[model samples]
Target: MQTGENEQALRKIIDFTRLLSIAILIIHFYLRCYHTFYKLKLTHEVVDHILLPLSKTTAFNTMLFAKLSALLLLVVSLMGSKGKRDEKIRAKTIVTYCVTGLLIYFFSSYLISWPWLYMGATSFGYLLFMTGGGLLFRMLKLRLGGDIFNKENETFPQEERLLENEYSINLPAKYQLKGKERDSWINIINPFRGTLIGGSPGAGKSYFIIRHIITQHIRKGFAMLIYDFKYDDLSRIAYNALRQYGGRSFYVINFEKIMHRSNPLEPETMLDITDAMEAARTVMLGLNREWIKKQGDFFVESPINFVTALIWFLKKYKAGKYCTLPHVIELSLVDYKELFAVLSSEPEIEVLINPFISAWRNEAYEQLEGQIASAKISLARLSSPQLYYVLSGNDFSLDINNPDEPKVVCLANNPQKSQVYGAVLSLYVNRINKLVNRKNQQKCSLIFDEFPTIYFNGIDNLIATARSNKVAVTLAVQDYSQLKKDYGREQAEVIMNIVGNIVCGQVTGDTAKQLSERFGKINQQKESVSINSSDTSVSRSTQLDYAIPGSKIAALSSGEFVGMVADDPGNKISLKTFHCEIQNDHDAIQQETAGYSEIPFPSAVTSSQVILNYQRIKEDVKILVDDIVDSL
Candidate 1:
């Protein structure tokens, strides 16, 4: 932002500096002529009487050198103060200023020598002056129209200032830049902005995410946490990329088969009670949003509070391995007398335990039991054996606190395990989001594929605030209906409103209409036909219509996407719609897919990943050994 301000200041200074420079030249010319005429030492009579302002033609140009030198220093100092990438912009400004000065100087000098050529110089000067005037008028018009010329609204040509494929620290490249003028380097789209991508199946949305947003950053070494939904294809590709890049580790949370365990209670949150409470709400809501919606907060708030208090206690006091959700389920079903006894000795937990103990003793104890039962039923899967094994250990963790090394995590959507682990996924997202915002020492990118498949409410708020904390969220979804269904209509709207970059592929129904509305309106040429039926002639008139119909957006081809990305600082085209093409990489994809099917386990854990407990593995082996002995 300081860089942009400096550039604007330098530009204005150059404008006034040129006027001063011209004034200096005129003054110096007069001074030299007056000195020579006063000295009266010219050799030729023709030189003495040359034109109207005949005077000394001094070979020594000391005054001109001094004035021009001082002017150059001031302009150079201004250019030197701007930020790094502004070097190119500053160079261009300097070159243009020098060229304009040279043009005026040469034309004026020649016009004095051959006065007839004054006509041509006058014509060129008039043209240049008029062009500058028109530009000034446009700037004035824009200002009066309420577009404040600040860091956000400053205009720059984006087409010429391309940042290339190697640069990646934040979410810098959302769309290709259009810019205000030719020869102006292409500027990056919003670097610190969040994006939401929408596309139906096989519309090439995933391909777009890979090529445009993640791939470069992955290669450039920005830490990332990706939720690869379909088959862990994205995760596998990123794993290979991280390996090739070297020095960075890859982690996986495979739900289909336990490749590795990341204790679900890992660092519950550093913040006091609020963070833990929000996580509890997320889990309960994620499990049964419709139920909670129907019952309202009054019915659900107490259960959430109960869970929240437990979460806070566990996270604050216990190790991550022992702080699993199963502990909560076990405590919930235990006798109230036992629970009271357990809380009796712990002074810190008495405040938390008092409310639940009193609730159970109420005259409406059965009603309270029903509410507690409802929350427990929704969370009953947490007590299952397979999931318990997966949530118990600390084998792999995906942390994006460090940007020098990138990280990626994949959560499998196993049907058998979905009910058990769905809430865990929500918890991880909520926790990771907290980590990203809290441990904001380095920038991180989190990509959630088919994001609506694992909906959360705070996603909109995350998108809005993540930029400040240097975290980027990349969400991909099929359609608006899915969002509305999973997150409700109001939250879906909030998500749409907060996301800075909206990328849409071929979509139909409400999603198409939403994208069309978001891509906004455009002025398009049209034709109108008129007829005069006086038995003589017919007149036809053509005109332009100011609109882009929604049908046009819906008809976009596969691999083609329409987007409205936030503008870069100093970018001229503010919130303009752009079309991007992301062609499928068939061979590369085939390699990634083939590798996944061949792996004995999804990750590097072991061959028998389907089985969970180590004791179960031994039990099965012992049973087989006994059968073999009996056969012998």
Candidate 2:
């Protein structure tokens, strides 16, 4: 009995609230109408001598009545006293009607005689009031209707919302335009999961990448690991100089220097490799537990772990003391058969360890030997023991160790050696992922300037999985055909599926087609016809047509391209061309080239030597031009 009484009381309260709201609305309507029409004497004046001298006054009256009827209908519709609140409030329709009424009222006033021009003036005033009132009411209804009714409400699914947020990093406003302000600029969205930026010899791909590194990455304090394959590329040296002279804090790992070190592969010397191995171990352990649960108790422990333990066991056995944490895991030919047998028994485990095992068996341990030896020599070579005191006294940290501080590391490498580039990129990405995952940070951006050339295995997995881990990767590539050529059909398809955002510039060929299909949906049209014969026979025909699937990549001007986010469906990718002005630094170029020398001859050489020879020519040209001016 108490519950029923409470329910009744609640119902009564709801009823009273609704009644009060309706009463307030009615009072407002009455006050607005009375103030606009009655007190103003608008209706009386309109019916009196408004259209007096015209023989078509009746027709004019009918038109005025019709327009006023529309205005009233719009007001009543907004009141929502009618049932079925799910109906959409047609604000556009209401505005159209109000505008039409205003037009009619103005034209009708022209029919009034000069003596009653006051009526015309009154009519004009009422027209303005009605039109303004209709527009204000319509706008309010449109804004508030969604809140009042469930039918009008809309929201994105949680996963899609998260994807949009994650993919928002590639959004042009975030990283594209920074430091240098411009009236206009071109933004190319790397649609490929990994993009490769390549062009004519002097197309400025590397220059663009370097500019981004210096301006965006370095300035912002994000860590970058550059593999300087090109011996001539000055980004690495420039970064070092910037740190020394400009007080820019950055970590530069000159892989060339590391490669040249006596024992560059040592765990202590190769910070990148050390971090990668540790990450590999963590991934292996996770996979091991998952495999154990899925395959049941019969599943054997991961052989990688067993091999690791066996290495420790062997180290302990040889050292004449218990194995410690520093005992490194190294495999040899003797363990090959056992490794293969274990891998065969557990194929899933093989997926995690195969690459590491391959690296170990092939070059990792030998590389470690070189690295370890090099560290000792480097320590020995330090002129000041105090500098060594800072280095040798503490454990070396990862390239991105200082999370609180921003550090930019440049991997300045040549693009000619595709495999080497791939290896370097894979190593850097693996290292960054480890650092980010370990720290469990809120956000980090991985910008790969030219992505596709460096084809790292499992990059697709990284794209799909990294978002949840707060790592956003942006890949800038030239075109789709380049990706298809390097990664082949299957891997490229896998890559495309993983990335949520796609920004494309002017493209041609298969890439353009693929992008068009992916970003632009198919539009279909249908036509139908029916005929009845004299003999009472009926016939019908129907036809359907479809626009060919293609990329929205039309031939754009130099800097134009289409861009799209995940949620937007139609015509969202449309964007004007962005023109980035290339800034000249003559003084810096001169200073950098001061000590640089040119090769004596480049008459006969391989394609790989072109970039090097080109640099030499540039230096020689500068010298020759200076000499000519001096002679003059």
Q: What TM-score would you give candidate 1 relative to the actual structure?
A: 0.63
Model 1 weakest lDDT span, ten residues long: 148-157
RMSD of each: 19.2, 20.8
Q: Residue by residue across 311-338, what tens digits does model 2's lDDT show?
A: 2232223241212111122122224334
Clashing pairs in 1: 156-570, 158-179, 158-186, 159-186, 160-184, 160-185, 160-186, 161-185, 161-186, 162-186
lDDT of 2: 0.39
Query: TM-score of every model?
Result: 0.63, 0.38
Model 1 over residues 222-334: C-alpha lDDT tens digits?
66777767656676667666666654556767655567676656654435667767778878877875743443565687677767766665555434323556555555555
Candidate 2 residue-wise lDDT at 100: 66
Strongest candidate by lDDT: 1
Off-target runs (Cα >4 Å) in candidate 2 are 1-210, 226-248, 255-396, 399-401, 404-406, 415-425, 438-443, 468-470, 485-488, 521-560, 565-632
443, model 1: CA deviation in Å?
Answer: 2.3
